[model samples]
Target: MPSLSPSSGQSGLSGRTPPSPSEALTVYVVDDEELIRTSLQGLLRSMQLDVRTFGSAEEFLAAPKVAGPACLVLDVRLRGESGLAFQQSLAHRGLAHLPVIIMTGHGDVAMTVQAMKAGARDFLEKPFRQQEMIDAVIGALEADTRRLAAERSLDELRSCWADLTPREREVLGHVAAGRMNKQIAGDMGIAEITAKIHRGQGMRKMRSRSVADLVLKMQALDVIRRAA
Candidate 1:
């Protein structure tokens, strides 16, 4: 609505502690009304969030996708497209990670239920309290932060798994099975000390600090999931 104003909120958010790199969050507001978008952007920027406003859902969708903790503030009624249907369609298109908080000037019970079922994180009627909107935005950002963190951890785990040698993977499987070094050595016809070396190498490669941690990480990476 504000034509995607590009201020970094430095002026708007002076005297406030800046968010750390990892703590920075974004909010996408898609409302056709200029006044509504301007108001929402001001409020969010004051809270030190990176705010981007769109005059239409299409404009927001056209923007390059951001892979961080972000939320979409979508109005229920939009130009040509119904926001509820758009939310469902977005999920269908595999964008279930971008959480939505629906807002409307003329909301009804049916619309609220439909929005909730479509995975809308929160619903707010027009003329909503600033605190209510802030709460919803905070909740959505927290959810996205957790989701992104889990995804990053899984990706790192997979990368570590990929770095392992075949022998390391084999040793990991035995470790996950709760086999002692001597038992693993017997199963593989190797010396117990060799088995221990291989096991230690695998654990290091997996970045695991403990046997239990290694087992859970391998299970998550599916490196020894079947054994687990």
Candidate 2:
């Protein structure tokens, strides 16, 4: 298997329209065979895409991690690590946002079902047309873009929460849990006037003008519940 960098074999993609700056996507190919790897690399390049290829799962993982919008075209049968196992490992390492399109010459109904259940973006049998691979790559890239956007939105929500004072944070939690000002005061053992003040401060800092807005923001930030 040959290890091709992103810069090599990219000329063929000259005619293919590239995504806008805000939409550019990276497509990575991982396979154990040199021919298959290069073939996919060329195919994607011909479409004016940014493509990279790795000889094995380990090689792919060892490469510098990319945080921008991207997707993977992975083979199910690798020399050392099975594609399914690698997918699981990516999930365990918190890299599941990188959408995977699993390809195999030995695909079965059961294996395809398992791949989908494991969060694969798509599964294609070997001997697929170039167009099929291209479509899958495009779909996976779009999914990754949406996922990254959602993460950014959540991060902003967390930052908004972080700006709150301790008392405001306490009030935020109470409000998010459906507590009225009077109930929140009772729970905090504070005067209703004080509770109202804290709640208003928290709402302002969180940029939430209403109770529903506060609840939605908290849910988006994944702060409503702890993992027990």
Candidate 3:
């Protein structure tokens, strides 16, 4: 990933500057206070980051879904609906995968603990240092990137697995269970020679170069089971 730098020119309601051309991070700042929002926007932009400011949780929600690597820096307090409530709503709606950093003026140890439990990537007190905020943002973005990559890989694995024939799938299951060809043949009521052929074909279709590779792929797909 490339480093981010701050940019000049105040944009949005907060008057926060934009990110520098060199910065690659995209950050969304949500706070009801215009001053705090603008300050954060400027701070981040100076670091060469892409910053977007939202006046409320509703405004943030109204924005389109983020497409690339990004994180949300959300305030703990908001008018009408609380930030914690908004976070819960996102989780309930299956949007918890998006990384979030909770910022609170009235933050306490208990609140921080609760936010961590609720899947916040990090928690920042209102008077936090610039370095602290930058570190949290970088950490959150890195985590989001890794998570999105994992999800994509899992989807591709599922699609590939779905292309297998029933017999191939059965062979895969036995192989993942550590069964040898002779043992699999006995279990399936087939000769060892027939089992070997089926196993070879299944391995080829699954694109597994070795038994270890096949087993790892099955584990990644969550299809490998331990014997009771």
Model 3, 36-151: lDDT tens digits are 88888877777677799999988988887657678899898999899988876787776777888998878999999888888898988867766667778877877777776788
TM-score-wise, the better of 1 and 2 is: 1
lDDT (10s digit) by residue, model 2, range 1-228:
322223335442333343454655688888889998888877787776778899998788788766778889899999998998898788777787889999998999999999999999899887775556777887787777778888888888888888888888888899988889999999999999999999988888888888888888887777786335
Model 3 weakest 10-residue run by lDDT: 1-10
Runs with alpha carbons beyond 4 Å of true place in candidate 2: 1-23, 177-197, 222-228
* 57-151 per-residue lDDT for model 1 (tens digits): 78988887676788999988899787888888997666888989999989899999999998999999877766667778878888888888899
What is the clash count for each candidate, in the order shown? 0, 1, 8
Best by lDDT: 1
Q: Which ten-residue region of model 2 has the weakest summed lDDT?
A: 1-10
lDDT of 1: 0.83
**lDDT against the true structure, each candidate:** 0.83, 0.81, 0.78
Ranking by lDDT: 1, 2, 3
lDDT of 3 at 102: 94
Estimate TM-scores for all models: 0.86, 0.76, 0.80
Model 3: lDDT of residue 172: 75
Better lDDT candidate (1, 2): 1
Checking candidate 1 for backbone clashes, the offending pairs are none
